[model samples]
Target: MRTSKTFSIQFWMDTKKSKKSEGLIYARINVDQKRLSISLKRKLAIKQWDSKNQKHLGASQTAKEFNRYLDLSKSKLFRCYQELRDNGEEVTSKAIKNLFLNEESNGYTLHELINYHSIKIENTHAIGSIRNFKVTEGYIARFLKKKRIDDISLSKLNFEFLCDFENFLNAYYPKGHPKAMSHNTVTKHIQRLRKIVTLAYNLEWIKDDPFRRWKSTFDKVDREFLSDSELARLATHHFKIDRLDRVRDLFVFSSYTGIAFVDIRNLTNQNVWIGDDNGNKWITTTRQKTNCKVKIPLLFRAEKILNKYDGHPVTEISETLLPKITNEKANLYLKEIAAEVGIQKNLTFHMARHTFATTVALSNGMPIETVSKILGHTKITTTQIYARVMDHKIKSDMDAVQKRLNEKARKFEEESELKNLREKIVEAEKTKYANLTKEQLIEKLNEVLNEKSDTN
Candidate 1:
């Protein structure tokens, strides 16, 4: 037996009969002291009725649904109902029905649902995944700690919360950073929230989904990649101190290799290999971030750099390829290098990967597919960011093409003028030859010829 009301629930009742039937558990719900119960067959017929009020309780289907509703409204069946009844003002059935209809019967008040889903994900996924979920869940908990889950209605998740949380993340832990949390980071948080909310809907935790009106903050994020000129400046810049200079070189090297700092720290001479058939040396490694293997051809500059450090004993000294330095010290030196090279953009260790993708590969006219493979990007779309930045290179290429066309046009004009001069010279020779007539030449030339012959 079952009952239905503003909320729906399922209850398990112990039965005396050895053979259990559909109506083994008789569900009862009190509506102003009126008890409603439906047998197994009746509960089945109205199982789909989301909500049936006192007015609609006349029909048999509605009556059974009402009883099932009552069954679900039991003390244990209703989650967070006590809080709602205590703190919330008397809400009309129509208002509650509106909430149910708004979410399309997903069941609103999603705190429990979010937590439950987070727990499941934590159990089944990686430690990093669980950590990220807990972080997002912490944000949600702090945001709605005072309010009941049901009170976190669709309208409450406005733009204010989004902006406020962004500011919060900016001030989180670190008291002052030059900038707030990155748009991509904040967007990830929002995405996690969306995932949990979606899970809640599927699990029937909340009746209304608040995320329908929500939009991603991803597009508006300031995800910057270093330019080729900026990268070149870092590579060629002269640092005052040897320590800073070596840091710059190593960072630039890692950028060219497209490997993260952690993986770069693990690099050894063994990781470098010369191709057998082609006889070309390349760095064969995998990215720590994506765990994808990458094989990047050794540029001449890269080979030269390695040759300089090849004989150096691997130690924590500046001579080593990867001189052991803390991330903070490494980044500090990188900032100085950027400043010395007249690069206005903020420099960081991670930017090296972007620099390699944008400068060493895409800017050099290498195909994006090839670049993506070199960078070990899981998806081509991740590599498409370089394509967007490559527009400036496209413009520069157009300028080169125009310059070539102009040079060719000038050469063609000069050739045409030379041909005209040659034609004129030929015509002049023909006119000069035609001027001497044969008869006059024979009579007049006889005396001259005799004189010339005698002189000869």
Candidate 2:
């Protein structure tokens, strides 16, 4: 149950709109009942045009060539229509017009694809994802300029082009950035490029995938988090400065709840509610990064922090659960707090999330499946990357193994004692058999054979 489509093209001139002696040539396209027109950017005098045949009425070489060009344009338009239809794209007059103009609907360019992707994900993807697309687009524009290329066609994307682009990225750095691009950063750009390329291929804008041979990988990085003692120190140490105290409270809250900075900053009273299990308070909200729902039960410490900030002037005005502060200022204050408290770890808001996953959750005998759910991770592997194994976990595992080994050794000793008893019994039977005379042994054997035959 699909509608059939029809396409037709014609050459014409708008005599009423023409202000010059020669009228401008145009190609008119009709798709089903819809119509559209594209200017050929050429002009022909009324006397030179053949109205009946839609050709120039002349024998001059210039006239013949112009007629041939018109025929070629018509043929190309038909081919574009057929290709689009075969690719299962809805054939519209505007789509055909864009194809003729080398726009994104047909012959997609790198810049056009980037813009399209940016617009497409504006509402659907995270802010970080959108920013990455914009940054990638800027880098691509610079790369093209450095190579003296106007624009790259989707068909021309290959391994060689990717290598050149990678080289360009290594040498290129954005303005105001402190350092050159790293391998992982360059790899991310290539990943975004691959995503766009895959989209183009799915849409039939490109026949071959250029990234088929390209390999992308990221180096593992060690992330820092607080230990249980360090977290307790931060919680107990009182600061004279009010701002530092507030930042400490916020960081500690995140460490206990496993919430990121953006999600924590946007938390409201509505997100906190009494759970059915023992009426414990819980935070029910959606993670901004993955849009996954996270329901974390607020521990005593996290609840106390919230209670301390309840009904504050800033919180009341903002209708949020906590006072709002810029992330930059929070990190700056964290460094000062860390220095004052003698904690050497580079303290950041995000590190609190890592701490929650490691020290507060996994290190305390929490299941990784539950931790992954609490952290709003789409996969358990992602949580594993975030959670680091502490020395205590290893020691606990080895302790369990040693206990199992002791139990196994005890069982083996008991089995060996039983085995010795059975051997003694066998020796006593052998002595009894050896004491029997040959005639008595032969009589016993004959009697056992007769009993076995009767049972069979």
lDDT of 2 by residue, 156-275 (tens): 778899999999998876689988898899999989888988887786676568888888989988999999899999999999999999999999999999998889999999999999
* Residue 343 C-alpha lDDT in model 1: 79
How does each model score on lDDT? Answer: 0.64, 0.88
Using all chains and alpha carbons, the TM-scores for the candidates as numbered come to 0.57, 0.70
Of candidate 2, the 10-residue stretch with the lowest lDDT total is 98-107
**Which has the greatest lDDT?**
2
Segments of candidate 2 deviating more than 4 angstroms: 1-106, 173-178, 418-456
Across 1-456, the per-residue lDDT of candidate 1 in tens digits comes to: 122235433333323442323224433433334444422212322333333332113567756665655554444323333333555644333333343234433344446566678678755665557788888878767656533343465434545766665566545553366666666777898888888777765654444456777777565434456777777767777677888876786777876777777767766776788866888888888775566888877877677767767766544354435556777888888777777788787888878777777767777777889878887788999887645456788899899999999999999999999999999999997776577889966776797789999999
Query: Judged by TM-score, which candidate is best?
Result: 2
Please count the clashing residue pairs in each candidate, in the order shown.
17, 0
Write out the backbone clash pairs for model 2: none
CA lDDT of 153 in candidate 1? 52
